[model samples]
Target: MTLDPQRLLRDLFDTAIAAAHPRQVLADQLPADRSGRAIVIGAGKAAAAMAQAIEEAWEGELSGLVVTRYGHGADCTRIEVVEAAHPVPDDAGERVARRVLELVSNLEESDRVIFLLSGGGSSLLALPAEGISLSDKQAINKALLRSGAHIGEMNCVRKHLSAIKGGRLAKACWPATVYTYAISDVPGDQATVIASGPTVADPTTSAQALEILARYGIEIPENVRAWLNDPRSETVKPGDPCLSRSHFQLIARPQQSLDAAAHRVRAAGLTPLILGDLEGEAREVAKVHAGIARQIALHGQPIEPPCVILSGGETTVTVRGNGRGGRNAEFLLGLTEALNGLPGVYALAGDTDGIDGSEDNAGALMTPDSLERAAACGVSAAERLADNDGYGFFAALDDLIVTGPTRTNVNDFRAILVLERHTDDH
Candidate 1:
């Protein structure tokens, strides 16, 4: 039976996404309702869907608000959902950030604040510190995205410059019992890093945030820099009374999603080798994956042919070119070049959130004939890549995967299927 690579890859992606859906993972993680009011407050790509799940599962009275990326919101009768900008903050996000603070502020001991945090929450909950303006925050955030800093490092800086991030939101909840349900998007799934750890105690200090900024050469406004230098601008640290009432739960993660895809690969009679959730610069990471694929095809070291390699985790792009693509596209473009259209190997790289960077497509796919197809279509793969135009390269061939807003994020999903070597070839 001839294997349908595209169908299989899409199925694997779908399976990974289904595994992390809030409805499937959240019901069991929710804390039992107490005597006080249950307030649901959150911000992320999946906040609305998570809020909807809470509304369906909770038996007691629950009311509050959550902010998600524009077009990522789900329908919820209660627990109002507000849509805002992602990857960058806007006035809507800032307004909702204030509202979230207000909802949890001055809460009683009996009150319960449930925070549904996922990837992209950091940007969605954009409340600059006292000395910093929103414009300053926006400028810094735009710089950070283009600066190629990893999520942890970017969020480290974000935590110190914000009023509500890095456990300050938990501090605002005060005596209320805070239950935080997180969908992990960062490497190692550190509870304190996802969505900038709004409800969890942050271990990253202001000094570290300053160091990261310096390391990345990201300049901040004068007031913002002064604020970071001040000790009072530090985020909530460990063992603080503000965090005493907080309970953090990791409901879903990248590894779990990868495992789901791995299972589907096995069911399809392909050896599933999960290359354990990689994290690095996107282009460099792609070259590494390409090297592995070549090794498998040549000597069959690591894992033999007819095997499928799967990986998940976020990758960064330095944004050197005026290209129209996100990290995933850049990764795939790098992979395509490294492979040189090697026969019997096909791959796909996509952001699980259904949007790769600011592009309309999730990511792109590459087949053994990808380069040939690009050439045939008068698209110079090498030149496009040099210009950091992965979207244009893939779009020319109509190979971009456009799944509009999966509503949940577990970082990037990547799959490479290596078929058996042909005896007639080489």
Candidate 2:
């Protein structure tokens, strides 16, 4: 088969995305026995897409509301799709969150609530706990994003501060059963971590959430601190009566997406080495991947050339610089700098959701001559890295991969393709 690095990498990403899409995973996960009337509610980048899938598969009277990030909306006759903010809370999210709680409330034991969840749901369903305000949630959310906290830690704090998350939604169903179908974007694929586990019982506590804030040196609001100290901020815990009727299922996950990408790469005639879902500081993780790629190129310890290294997981950025780049772009920039323009190394890192750190582009691509192209354009690789300007650096070389609103997110997708080494290639 002919080799086109850019096309192959992008195709692999698309294939992985297709594998986790609601259409691919939701139908099989539909309820086998409908013991009650169904009401659907969800919040996330993929909620609208999930709603569409539910409408297409289920044969019943379904009506509900869901919130999704703007531009990710899909037409659903039964499920009303509302656009909201993400990675940060907004008034729109705040209002829709209240409606979701009301919709699930007052249901009988014979009623069932179908909740669709995915990455970005945490921010999309932003309803502050008692004594807290939307602005307060927004402030804490911004701090969490900039504090370099991982998704789990961020959601821990969010669940404690939320009125609907951390199993509160399920609690509202009372004797009714709440069925939660989630697409996992976190490292461990824990049901409790995805979208802050709106319908799943949380084992984490308010005290732990406060501790995470302190660990990250994030400043907590006076009321938020007071609420955290009080028991009212506590999420629904395990063995609670509210959780007995909750049914959680992971229909899609990051590792599954990674495996799907690897399968496609192998089918295309290149050996694929899946590194599994990874997490950490983007640059630090890039350094590790850079070392592995270097080993394969210089010594071939792991495998010979013509192999693609793939991984999926959410990476963090401290946001020290005012650079316009997401974690994936930062990872590629860090990888590029660490590789130092090594021959036969090409890569692409992107969020599966088609948005990277609130940027328009999905992510960026890197080639052996990427640095050279930047140099010719008078963009210093080191300086760009210093400013956390990976997006700018790649944009200068016309290497950004832009795909608008894929509607489904399984977290970060990274590919490092190492071609066969030659003496002259060096």
Candidates in order: C-alpha RMSD to true structure: 1.4, 1.3
In order, the Cα lDDT scores of the candidates are 0.90, 0.90
What does candidate 1's lDDT look like per residue over 1-426, in tens digits? 789998888889889999999999999887665434698998899899999999889888889999999999999998999999988899999999999898888889988888999999999999999978889989888998998888889899899999999889989999998899999988899988899998888888989988988998988777988999999888888989888899999999999999999999989998998988788888899999998888888778688889988998888888878879998999999999889988989999998889999999999889999999998889887898888899999998899999999989999999999997644323
How far is 223's C-alpha from truth in model 1 (Å)? 0.7
Per-candidate total of colliding backbone pairs: 0, 0
Candidate 2 RMSD to the real structure: 1.3
Stretches of candidate 2 off by over 4 Å are 34-36, 422-426
Error of 2 at 195 (Å): 0.7
